[model samples]
Target chain A: MDRAVFFISDHTGITAEALGRSLLSQFPDFRFERTTLPFVDTEVKLRAACQRIQASQRDSGQAPLVFSSLANAGLRTLLMASGAVVFDVFEGHIERLETALGLQSAQAVGRAHGFHAQGRERIEALKFALDTDDGLRADAYGAADIILVGVSRSGKTPACLYLSLQYGVAAANYPLAEEELERVELPRTLRAWRDKLFGLTLAPERLHLLREERRPGSRYAALPQCRREIQAAAALFQTAGIPCLDTSNMSVEEIATTVLHRSALKRLRW
Target chain B: MDRAVFFISDHTGITAEALGRSLLSQFPDFRFERTTLPFVDTEVKLRAACQRIQASQRDSGQAPLVFSSLANAGLRTLLMASGAVVFDVFEGHIERLETALGLQSAQAVGRAHGFHAQGRERIEALKFALDTDDGLRADAYGAADIILVGVSRSGKTPACLYLSLQYGVAAANYPLAEEELERVELPRTLRAWRDKLFGLTLAPERLHLLREERRPGSRYAALPQCRREIQAAAALFQTAGIPCLDTSNMSVEEIATTVLHRSALKRLRW
Candidate 1:
């Protein structure tokens, strides 16, 4: 059986879509027909959305589902009159929060994507990630939220970028150089910040494949070299008691999420 | 007046918040209290969300707005019974799309955030962004989807990074050197691929302030120098007819969106 789903909002409707996709994923047996009606701040657009929902309900013999983030009372009333199942994204809860916090929301549109303090902070974090990427700027450890230590091509750069990009985290990554690995001790620059360190390791085969793309036929890309480095990096992480995740089978999203959870890092508000 | 808003989902509820925030912002006269109930896959969680919504309605004398993307029919039914306004984000629309395309959705959960072919493509784009940043690999320009040209502190790096991180665009950026800027022409290497080039210009004052932070008191941070560079860059863009946007007073989101839209670049499905 097929049902219609609508994501209605005054802006991009990106948020509605994200939440809708997630919720809808749980029902693996049913098929959904999805459409987004963004920039629906006007009464006409709201009525159009209502018509679409009603048409779907009529055609399919099921109540059409609506995922809406509408903030206007008049529009909400208009949507409700459609007689389709509606999910109001913000109505009842905003009142509770306002009462509890003793403050009124700005009731402004696109504030989530607008330029503000948090957005500035995120931009700064991205610049920090770029500046401190790949073990650059050794003196800037004091400013880092967390530092990732790993061997070459073990997926340090993307992991750090993801943390900053997704969470406004000021992440720095250091490549464990061969000389430092031979000594089998944490680098002098990182010793003071060991508490802030997380390690990344990749499978030998994966590491070899990634390295070969960058410096093919070099010792760095050789399978044996990858194995030795992986072993050494793992030993360093274990001996130092630094929390680590194997990136061999993990996406950057998974790695960044795990690292943040393990580190107990607080994500900046979205 | 204050109202309650709920972002209900079986996953992160991020989308509900985004679309919800955007929609509510348009009605700046009304204040909203907000809550998010994610992972509402179980009947228990769904009921908990309902109780919260009902309680808010009881207290506030207004129904809470619900932005949901529930895929499961049973869960959707359970949520609808709460007597709150509901928005079915996927059900009504997926069927329409399936009908139009003559295919059924996979009906999988977490498809938006899950690792798939798109994920691999994004990863590759990110790697490309890192490799091609700051005009390091001119020989690899052919691999780029778009190449951003700008002077230092004109915001090319962050723009490229945003394109790759959010949209999976293989964006490369070139920082026009002082010598090249004096020449008042696109660099020899870039001329061949002029069509792929996009220019970024920053406000003189903003550029000056930004440059001063890195190279304090240097000529590059001087107002006159900043003005000169901005003029030269704008002139170059005009002569070459390369599309450009001012980075000053624009968030990275705004810049990236404009560039992608103006350039007719395709954003990968997230």
Candidate 2:
């Protein structure tokens, strides 16, 4: 039978979904329908969530699996007995933590991604990332926490976006165009931000494939062109002593983490 | 003393961090030093993780809080016995799930956000989001799963971006410039894709505040101008019979969720 998986949370259900997916991924053979019930911070909403779970169980003729990060003890206890297989994503751990540390968890609600408390800062950071994306607004460099420099399709854009969305870092990326690639020195605009400059590089084969997807059979997509550009970019970054990361096999999360770690750039600690 | 909190995972530790932070945020009075350790897929890595936890305990002279989403049972057992306050982010749930479902989880590793299996698709979607942002490439609308429309700073860009990054949705956003807002009708390019079009509106005060940050005291940032633009934009959206969402007082996650639900757009389904 196809199973139902619910990710329920008092705030943004991102955490419940993430942890639940990691576990459910292990059981890939089973067919599953996933639902997210976020901001279930009220008793009324919790009742509706329970009704949905009970309905899923009735419709599927099997117990539905629930992964919850609900912080309210009363709601959690209510959810646990809601006729579904409940997975308290945080309760057991919180209890253990409370005991080991001789402290009690405050069980606060909706602070993870509330955004309202610090919405202006995060919104500005996100705007900064979008406005300065792909070197669109070079004049704004003075406000950037760090600037990512790379050849086209070296994974600069997504890395910047991830850093902004996940860490509230004001990241801007500058593409090393053909002229800059052929030059040994860093671009004129980047020289002023030398300390804040970071580079992203990738394998020639990967670059060729990524470019080919956009412009099939073009000179830009040729393996030789990719190789020469990467070599030039690498040399330029090396001579300039700019920190670089190879994003050929790394996910955006990994690239962002590595860049932040290597540069020690300050994140707007959300 | 500041408490140490570690978000441990077999993959990108993002899940552990998100949920852990949500739970920990409740205890606002306590100071915390957060650390994320991803890709703990081996015994060696687990041992090193234990060492880190042990050292934290020793340095702080207090039990360190660990939130883990590691899927391997053997490794989880080893981690539980580590010298920290262990929070099994997934185990108790997984065990109960197995018993209730009458099936065994595959215990596979690195499946949540494992870009290796689907990186190309996600990268393409992200690139699409960037290229089509702010109506840059209008011709590419045919390729988009959904198009977001609203005046500048109406929360369209970030919502589009979040949809792309999190769910691999090919979301394109267009600004309702003065010309379009004054016309009282959807733009020519958008009229063709009416079914794919979604609208984002925000409170005039919020828009004024957001725009003022970028360009202080300009017409674009004036409260009166914002009020007029938003009124015209909302009227246009309403007259055109297009569905719209108000982004005021809502997080980007909430806006994205509401948009996806209202439009029933197909998510890339990662």
> Distance (Å) between predicted and true CA of A227, model 2?
2.3
Q: Give the per-residue lDDT of model 2 (tens digit) for B59-95.
A: 8788788888888888889998987777777756677
What candidate 2 gets wrong by more than 4 Å, as runs, is A97-116, A136-142, A183-185, A191-195, A235-243, A262-267, B41-51, B100-116
DockQ of each: 0.21, 0.52
Per-candidate total of colliding backbone pairs: 58, 0
Worst 10 residues of 2 chain B by lDDT: B110-119
Give each model a TM-score.
0.73, 0.88
TM-score of 2: 0.88
- What's the TM for model 1? 0.73
User: Can you write out model 1's per-residue Cα lDDT over A61-80, one digit (the tens) per residue?
Assistant: 87877877766667888887
